[model samples]
Target: MPVRHPAPTPPFNIIRMSHIELGVTNLDASRKFYTEILGLIETEQVGNSIYLRGLEERNHHSFVLTKVERPHVIRLGFKVASEADLDSMATYFGTKGMATGWVTQHGQGRSLQMRDPFGMPLEFCYEFAQAERMLQQYGAYRGCHPQRIDHFNCFTPNVQASHDFWALELGFRTTEYTVSEDADPQLWAIWMHRKGNIHDMAFTNGAGPRLHHVALWVPTAMHIIHLCDLMSTTGYLDNMERGPGRHGISNAFFLYVRDPDGHRIEIYTSDYLTVDPDLEPIEWQLRDPQRQTLWGAPAPKSWFEEGSLLAGANVQPPVLQAQPIIAS
Candidate 1:
């Protein structure tokens, strides 16, 4: 048996998930879906790119969409603690033989862009322009009224390898995880965080380098219900893919929807905090069907098999075979 070592202190600091860029086929349709349906406030429009922010956000943007030939994920952005951390990260990743470089395209300063060992495109920055926060503007609330970007869930070929890279090397703490039922347990999925909540990111063993979903936090459980109502009334019932259900892993209330371009977005709330260094992560057995949905509803096959392709990832082969789960 391999000895379990403690997660290492990261050499560089990542503050939180700052933004995400998605490549969309129809700029106008996707913008309307996000702004009119999802309630994200448009912060700026430049050329073929549109920047958006949640109601509680003060940043110029937390989500960006670019006109592209197909729908895909461009990058996952994280804010580093300082400009110095950017320099440190560049050196750290470069020393480890990962591709690293500076990007000046996203209204950021001296940003470091790199592909992690798993080939996920990540951007790190210390500065971005701020915007007016619309948290108190009740009249401006249109749809689900998302507060902020909660977390990103992605698919990887090897959950254990990706989990170690984030939890060990990137200084993220595991809040919850699922393990296989083998006599010797194996990692099946993991939820890790840097911002003291349930997770800033999570990985499940699946197809390589695909985005499972980008989650946005709504203010309350009622907000989730309101969004479902809005979607149904607004003729977007086809977009509602799954749930107004609770998850056993994060204890979050969730509703999954698909954008016009087929990218998945999750409206979520009610996850517990996880900031203490000594806090032990909650683990779930793979055979426990409630680990995914506490309400006894099972996720559809499309939810498991469909995900957005990443723009620059070198796809890898899947390592784990899918298994049957219990459903009520």
Candidate 2:
């Protein structure tokens, strides 16, 4: 188990898990999938990149796809409380002996880029150009009608270390966790949040710094079911990888699908709120079947074995290397 420390008052403020920059091999193919099939609104296209956002999102974009030969998670983005928080973040990373740099992003203001202790690429920004929201634009709705960017799930080599840093240093609260049932158990996975939802981010015990999936919040379970039917008829049936099932952990109704670049995306809904400061994290044993899926078959090997590579980082196998039960 990871050692516990009193959660610190962070010097900087983070408002929410904001956006993501996903690198794809073929921008055109990815644009079609994310825009047409996933129902993400295409905001802009510049050179080799495409900018997109969900229907209800007012920000310029929550997702960006850039052309790259290797498909990888380019960077994760967060909304900070103020522009001064950028300097505070840089100082925080510097004190930890980690380097941070400022990068100018189109449609967004000043941003700081750095890698976490586990080397997950991250960015923090405060100002983003607002876009016209299409929430009530009934005629424009298509695919699953993604409402907004939800959360990110990452596979990490050292789950405990990752958990501690985010909880103690960055002030994230754990909403749920799983423990390996070894003689002396260890933290096998954790769901931590800055925003009031169940998770802004989750770290699962696995090989280092890989993206498990980027979840998009859809309106209802019917949206997910609609996606399944649409995919079956539109030659995207094979992209439907997992579920139309519920997770015991978050009680979230979900369906996992693969994009043109093999990056996993989860269409998610039906999770409950977790805003209470004293709310206890739901715990699950590593071998518990229900924790992985409240119903339906176990997740297949591909779901367990495959994930998008992180940009500019090398992979490291987990220290414990404990495997969870998967579909046989």
Candidate 3:
């Protein structure tokens, strides 16, 4: 089948991502892993759930680990331009035959939730409460000192279909793509963005619509090494999936880890900014080792196989398929 593409819109002009809700089998263990090992500060706690953010950020919370009966992703919250946009989006998706749900007076703002055709959970809102920045004088080596939750990558069996839903219905633009050199012209990977910085999200051809990893941005490369060392000392070295390497495309330092539920989370830094109207999308050959890792180490099998499931009241089955080659 031919890959379906979404209609392009002007780049997003608003605040960036706010927080990502992660579902964990054991909320306490997951909270320790993030707060103690990763050095994120706990901002608030409501019953079994805990809200966290980097010490450097003043946002209410950048990461929310919720206590769910199972392991999965609850929803990814993006700060919209205004509450009006949220209502419009809710009606927009409704017109397209997608169901929409609303949450009033929630954590940061009143929000609306929906699912894509492939079953990924998405939420949009404008009611977030801001906090004071807390790391002004931590002096050079704040553990994991991430500024904000940046982007996420997901796997989709029908990459083209998922791309169309995000790009056409939502307002996302393509920043890069991976094309197979062999026959069939299959899309191996696609980097997409909402407003700027090359990509805020990406899609890879894989088993189903699963979240591959959520990328958090740190101020410098040293923070990545510090966090890796911390993970090692805390006896969580086994969680380190890959990393402390430069990416051939983003030119950023990256480290990947598998949380308790096997969901991958990336600690990334130093990628260049993309704010120009004419920024060209980068295309990498599927067979190039440089495409996977700029420093030459191959990504482990687990990193390729594991990801977070989407969450909502009515969860959908994943679009299953055989695994493809590792990007390199």
Which candidate has the highest lDDT of all? 2
Clashing pairs in 3: 108-127, 109-127
The better-scoring model by lDDT among 2 and 3 is 2
**Tens-digit lDDT track for model 3 on 100-142?**
9988634677888777787677777777677667677565324
CA error at residue 189 for candidate 3, angstroms:
1.1
Q: What TM-score quantifies how close candidate 1 is to the native fold?
A: 0.96
Q: Candidate 3 — which residues are off by over 4 angstroms? A: 1-7, 10-15, 137-142, 312-328
For residues 57-99, write the lDDT of model 1, one tens digit per residue.
9878899999999889999999889988988988887788888
Best by TM-score: 2
lDDT of 2 by residue, 215-302 (tens): 9999899999999999889989999999899998899999999999899999999998888877878788888989899973588998
RMSD of each: 1.7, 1.2, 3.1
TM-score of predicted model 3?
0.89
Worst 10-residue stretch by lDDT in candidate 3? 313-322
Per-model TM-score, in order, reads 0.96, 0.97, 0.89
By summed lDDT, the worst window of 10 consecutive residues in model 2 runs over 1-10
